[model samples]
Target chain A: MSSYIALFGNPNTGKTSLFNNLTGSYEYVGNWSGVTVEKKVGILRQHGVPIVDLPGIYSLQPLSRDEGVATDFLLTEPCSAIVNIVDASQLRRNLHLTVQLLEFGKPLIVALNMVDVAEKRGVKVDAEKLSRCIGAPVVPVIARTGKGTKELVRAILSLSEQSGEREHVAIDYGQDVEAAVQKISEQLPDDLLASKRWLALQFLEGNERIHAYLQTYMDIAPLVAVRDEAQQALGRPLAEHIYDARDKWIVHAIETSTVIFQQKPLTLTEKIDAVVTNKYLGLPIFLTFMYIMFMLTFDWLGSPLADLLDQFFSGPLTEWLSKLLTLVGASPFIQALVLDGIVSGVGGVLVFVPQIFILFFFISLLEDSGYMARVAMVMDRFMEAIGLNGKAFIPMIIGFGCNVPGVMAARTIEQPKERLLTILLLPFMSCSARLPVYALFAGTFFAKNQAIVVFSLYVLGIVVALGLAKLFSSTLLKNESSIFVIELPPYRMPQALTLWRSTWDKGKGFVRKAGTFIFGGSVAIWLLTYVGPKGIGVSMDDSFLAVIGGVLAPILAPLGFGTWQAGASLITGFLAKEVVVSTMNIIYHAKDMDLLQGAITQHFTPLSALSFMVFVLLYIPCLATVATIRKEAGSRKWTLISIGCALTIAYTISFLIYEGGKLFGY
Target chain B: MVLTDLRQGQKAVITNLAITNEVVKQRLLHMGMHEGEKVCVKCVMPFGGPVMVEVDGQYICLRRKEAACIGVR
Candidate 1:
């Protein structure tokens, strides 16, 4: 049998990096918490076993979906050995989970990570002493740069070879709690798989999920009786006492196994946070960073490269593809599909790849530099007004990159109402997929201030989303928990390699999307314009794309850009936002962006172009997002309401922008 | 006094976490803020924002209300 090893740790402890080193696979690693919200499995080359990387969770008892994912996997998943990663700098707190894992009765090897960081703070840990104390093999390793990883791998393989269970070590939970734990363990059914003491302790600590799971196997009445009896005798919640025991043990363990010296004061992260997270200056600093990012992407590097790629695809590439088709004696229909449909459609979306990567680069920087958690702290006040804490804002930041993961990131919110609200508001964050449409329109019409123009749309998306969050909180989902406690990881300069890898991870999806479904979508769309209800080779005006677009056009006229071509593009945009540019390219029969720009000018003024971008910014999310909403929301009614709300808000906002612009005589 | 009652940069040993919410209390404990631990105020954001607190070299940001539930001396 192939053995499986699970890598577990607290959030932001570099477990993903360690997994990458062991498995030789690239998974997105973020310095902030909750980056890995689900379990990821990769094969470990050294041991020839599958390594499961679970989410970074503070405890086995869950308060949120992501935590539940990790907790569930730890309790239920079958693994021959467990490699528990502990951040040495934060060992006291991280050891709480380490104790629970030890109680899990598995062959465990503890990987003590960040020892160098600990040493920097005048703390020195004796790995041999820690190993002796915990009764597990401990190896110090730096997960980021592969320092001391060989020892960790050796320990893991040696333990895997033994195939023996570690002795289940029970923490002294005082007298009453110990009595209850013993009773609960004896009463537990034989069918139970995990350690009975671990489950009973978890139950006493108010792990409702485990409690519910245990009820299915046994009556649980005897256990509940023992718990209530223990609670009455103790005069404090068993959980608090359990934590008290853990804290006492940690203090003792630290004294015996570690040494502390006077620490260096005021690191670079502190000096920077003094200004960037200052009361008055934090929001301004955040806005400035965003402004700079946009300026780089739109007005500087990204736009120029995108323009070059656009011209190449529109002129030389299209001409070369056409000639190749002619040389092969292909049919006129096939030639049109390859050139007009696939090339123009996919090529139109492909040109924006540079901008997508630039945006990803900035996002990765913010995430890797540990700025995102501070943004949560900085944005807490406004978030409170919307009935959420600063922790909820992390999902919004992630949403600016892509809504699917952003929506999934909501799993970390801890509050069900807030998680749903975050999901509902995510579509308005203006994902990178929509960047192409905004860049095309802004570059074409708002040339001198394209950066400012695109930046305003991003701000608009936030304003509208926040406003709706406020509305939903007051009317639909009332009584938020308003609990916000977040860990602030120390800032480090983002490594160049990590930044490149992260950017490529996010940006590759766009290109792969273009190569796969978007290629087919483009061909299908071109055929819609090529073959209509009037049959093959009908005029675009009479094509099926036009017929459906015509139905939606009048409704959009009030928001400007009411033409059939614009309507058809919006219709295809439902498939994916990049397809909007593709549909427009094919409809205008434009060979290059220069031609596409000239063709759009005939149908839209600068004001109308701005209005059209606004609609795309707030309108319904792509099909993948809608499916995620359906699944994550877990209710058909909520999903429909989400779509309905997005459409209503999009129309209202676009109408206001268009008519309001005309009223001001712009 | 409560955790938020401390001046910025003032350090104190935690006496108790007088919090009722089960999840919040468990979370604070798991984050290494149990009784007898030491914590120092780092900064408090302006206008009802979260207060940044440092405990054993790890920084944690907590809402003012939640921070108030933590007793220190």
Candidate 2:
């Protein structure tokens, strides 16, 4: 029988960091709210008990999909204890959830995280006093540096050791509301998961989940009547009355245990925000940061390392591996499988790992430094004008790294219509996987302006995504977009370990995909290219891959890369975007990357190559992304809409580019 | 007046939330925007963007339209 303890907190309270410290597992920790969309489970190292990290939530009554997940988990999962983490600096606001958590009556330990940050602002929290007042052990811990983590773990172990019947603190809603709650509670089944009083409060507040639960066990009309009676007596929505009660309770708790010195002057975060989020300077500063990030990724760091790796893979690695295979008496077919299929296919994708890592590194830095939230704040108006909210920008930026998580990140957007629209347009943000295609083409065709060419493609993706978002909002998913109420957390230096872990987590996914999807895809493509309808070892032109590519070539003819090789690479790209580069690597038989670049220049004029890159940028997202769209959107209709819209947009844009170039006679 | 009427650096107490949408109301309440809580207008983004408000020691950025629904004095 394994006991479970859940780490719960408000957003950006360092719940994930504390979970990481206790469980020794690195889950993605961001400085903004809603970073952890799903709950993650890991075993505590000291107690060997499984600890779950729930998504950050404000209250038991969920306002968003991610918050609903946290609430749902607490309702369904049986846990021995809950380690409720709260930001000490925002103790009053954070305690709103803590007060609600106390209603569940589980063995609870309150980890007051970020105490040092609070102290810096001239706020002092008496932990022992807070512990006594809240009736839970309050441990001051800095989750980022792992300070007080051992004490936290010890508290949890001791909490589980005690009999789970702890004193539950209940807020006293006024007499009328209390009477209504008591009336509703008397009707609830004894075997219910949470306290009857909690359920009654939820019922009176018109919680949909609680209402539906009442419908199953008993006739909900009586409960509804009592709730209405209570509302009529209280002269307000039950939720409002309940909120007032909890607010008073939280204010009392804060006044008892916390002291504030004289108001501090504008802190570092405010000073930074004064400029970074200035109305006139905000967008420019954001754009400048983006430019710097891309410059660093492409020109300064990533591209050079990628080129070095490309040379190593094409020259020394291939030579040594081929020689070793020949010495082992491996047949020529086996040699091709090892050196060409596995090595070239996976290696071609791996060559871009440096660029991907650097891109993720900057993204993590932005997210962990708390700048990502401000980006959302600055971009909100622009996004709202285009029929979305500012928060949608966060996912779009994430889409630059990959569309799968970008689409999933839309869960943070409370509006269903806006979220769906965000998911549909996410593929237009040319992800890092598509970088290899751009790098290969831009480096070859537009060598003098490779950086500019790549930058233009990214800009093009955003423009198209926005255009389509506007179109969708006006037509298909039209609705009043939800209000934007995002928190701007104080800026802090990103912890090195957390930053490295996030970068590695994203980079590791790329490597794993390269190993499995790209490796298998490369072999399948190799077989198709090698074996003709007649037999094996046929000329490349007569191979089955050529036959298929020839069939698909006409569809792509207007985009200017209608050749069989382009068609085949685009087809393989469905597995993953990077496979397009690997497929081209295998088909052109350019073992030397320099020769490959030369071969590409000979085949594609700069204009046609640009058209092709644009096509790849807007075309159907990889299969994983499409599947994620289906899951996230929860409708085949919307998934097909996404795929259809992407394909149509890609073709239309590429066609215009290709024909428009021909008119210019470049 | 609604929260949007507040000038930069103006301080007021939230008098009421005029939002009709339940989700929006819940979200605001969860962020500690209950009536009687003190709110300070931190900054207003140009071009009618969000109004940044400091409440309960947290800086929250709300769109102008959303802010328009927040009654304050």
Candidate 3:
């Protein structure tokens, strides 16, 4: 069995970067907080010991779901030693968590990261003196460059070899707090003997999570009484009293060891923020950033790569397979299944890969450069109408490119309620996948003003998403007590290597999902179209796909596009939104877009065409999006709600559009 | 004075948090914001957006509703 080391720290303190350094692994690192939302394990190569990198948190008291992950690991997990990463530039605030870790009574080694940044800002720390003050070995490190990592690794191996138990640090608070600590310590159970002092301190500070954990082992009536009495004794909050005592001890340590040259604080960050967050310039700046990212991802870089991929699959790969089948004397049925069903089915899903990676690269850049926090702050005012803060806005914007990445990007939101709300509302963002359907319909129905029609659909998606968010946040998801607060980290230029690694990390999920879920969904749709009860390779009108479409067509009658051909196209659309157009092309026996558009004009009027597009816009999300939602949401319940909500809203809205058009004599 | 009442470049020492919710109070405390922490308003966004404040060399954004609960002077 291998011994394990627990890596912990305050959020955005370079904990993940240090973990990446020690373990020789590349996990995502972001400037803003809450980027690592789950615990990850990597091996220390030299020693082969497991290092568990827990989510970054300020203290044992969790403010959000990710913070709870760190706090739970601290209380429950057993480790040989604890590696606490403290940001050197923000020493005072980082030390607040370090103080709590000291009282945790584990063998501790503090990795003082970002020393170079601290030095440039005129802040210096004497590692040995600070170590003596905190009763731990402090290794000054720069995680970004792997500087001092060798010594840090050596210190970690030595720290783990030492005895795991140590005397917990007991700071002498004012008389009132100390009195209450003594009484609460007496009331703790025997099982919590070693941690009684720390538990009592946390209990007095109103850490409800710790209080509830203690409740299972002992009756907490007396502990509660002590806390109330202590709060009454101190005219101010008891936590402040405790903090003040720790600050006094820290001040002495800082005065003795640390030196400050009194340079202006964060001049670069302050200057950049002044203009980026200006009253008039903030929003326009953010919008410009978003537009640049979209253009790069969709037009400048990603589009050419995707087009090349499309040509390879349809032009070369399909022809090569056909030649091979002909030379081998294979049956025509086998040729159709191989070329049309498998080749085209899989290729269609693969075409989106470039866009996903390019979009993820830009997202990683935003998160790493520390501009994400500012984006949230700038958008919070507009998002307030939906009862959400600005963090929820990031995922929705990303959804405009692809919903799979959009759903995965919701992890940055700290609170679970906001994250879930963002995920549920993602389908209505009018992703690039739905654009083909809009192009086919809008080109035929509203040829004179194609841009306006497409833009109107995009605006409708946003308006409905916002309206539903406002409804759900106040009703079903109203339980969270979260406050709107954002921590603005200093902007740093993202390194090329880090940007690539994180982009790969995020983009890989979308690819894997496409490979498994989308692949299977395409095969299933193809199978239904290829065979019917009448016989194998029967016409699609008499096939099982058509039967299913007929079942759905009646329900869609009120929405004005009630034919089985419309229904069949929608059934295949579930596999991927792009498949709907292809399915219509095949079922309607139209070999090209002009033929399809000519045929569609004969089957429906302009009003029905618009309603059909609306139905496609708000119907259930594609299968890959559903699968990603299930994995990210972590519950079967929310995934169903997302699907059901989309289906219901799509139906109601499309029906209104079609019927109201008739009532107004359109 | 409440925190939101401070203009740009105005500094204030946090006095008492007039919040009834204990969890929100704990969050504020854990951010190194307590009774005596000095904070300077870096910028106040228009249309009642979040106000960016610099405290102890750290910048944080606090919305108007939560900022108003911070008793400062």
Better of 1 and 3 by DockQ: 1
Model 2 agreement with the true structure over A483-510: per-residue lDDT tens digits: 6779888898887877898999989999
- The best candidate by DockQ is 1
Which residue window of length 10 is worst by lDDT in model 3 chain A?
A585-594
lDDT of 2 at A605: 84
Against the true two-chain complex, what DockQ does each candidate achieve?
Answer: 0.76, 0.75, 0.73
- The runs of at least 3 residues in candidate 3 whose Cα sits more than 4 Å from the true structure, single-residue gaps closed, are A1-3, A167-169, A174-183, A192-194, A229-236, A296-304, A326-331, A395-424, A430-458, A473-482, A557-569, A572-613, A621-642, A656-666, B71-73
Q: Per-candidate TM-score, first chain only?
A: 0.97, 0.97, 0.86
Where does candidate 2 stray beyond 4 Å?
Answer: A1-3
Docking class of 1: medium
The better-scoring model by DockQ among 1 and 2 is 1
Model 1, A244-332: lDDT tens digits are 78878877888889988867654887899889988789999998998889999988899999989988897888888889999999999
Model 1 bad stretches (over 4 Å)? A1-3
What's each prediction's clash count? Answer: 0, 1, 0
